[model samples]
Target: MLDIKVLGPGCANCIKLESLVKEVVSEKNLQANIEKITDREKFLDYGIMVTPGLIVNGKVLAMVKIPTKSTLEHWLEKESSI
Candidate 1:
């Protein structure tokens, strides 16, 4: 399963990112464990300095901005291959 993490401080953009991840997962029929990490300390532990970050498995994929559907799907697909 894809271990997906969305790191943020629970802002509107962060919430929207979470929704986008879910939508992409359903659209792609991906089996994933989606996690929302809102704690700043935990977010820092991952070495991410930006909000609304996307971490696929253990690697960070995006930061600050919400990702497009194609990008989300592509990242998840790549991670699923591993």
Candidate 2:
């Protein structure tokens, strides 16, 4: 299964990103372990200096801005296959 983490501080953008991640995962029918990290220290641990960050399989794929649904889907699909 894919290990996905959405790092943020509970801002609007952060919440949006988390929702989008869930949407994509469900749409793709992926077996993923999705986690939400809200602690600032933990965000830094992932090297995320932005409001929203996306990590897939231990790799940071996005930060600051949310990716388009298609892009997000592509990323998740690529990672799931590996």
Candidate 3:
């Protein structure tokens, strides 16, 4: 399974990014667990300096902006194949 975490302060962009990840995962039929981490300390623990960050399987995939659905889908598909 893919482990995905969204790190942010529950802002608009943060929520949007989380939503986008969900949409992509569903559209691509990815078996993933999406988590939202809003705690400041936890975000720092993940080494996230920017809000709206994406951590996939303990690795940081993106930060600060919502990624395109196609990009996210591609990523999920790749992870699933591995």
Top lDDT: which candidate number?
2
Scored by lDDT, model 1 comes in at 0.90
Query: Across residues 1-82, which tens digit of lDDT does each residue of candidate 3 receive?
Result: 9999999999999999999898888877788999999998888888899888999988888888678888888777887777
lDDT of 2 by residue, 1-82 (tens): 9999999989999999999999999999999999999998898888998879999999999999899999999999999999
C-alpha RMSD between model 2 and the true structure: 0.6
Stretches off by above 4 angstroms in model 2 are none
By summed lDDT, which 10 consecutive residues of candidate 3 come out lowest? 73-82
Q: How close is each model in CA RMSD to the real structure?
A: 0.9, 0.6, 1.0
lDDT of 1 by residue, 1-82 (tens): 9999999988999999999999999988999999999899898888889898888989988988887888888888888988
| Whole-model lDDT values for every prediction | 0.90, 0.94, 0.87
- Alpha-carbon shift of residue 66 in model 2 (angstroms): 0.2
What local lDDT score does residue 54 receive in model 3, on the 0 to 100 scale?
A: 93
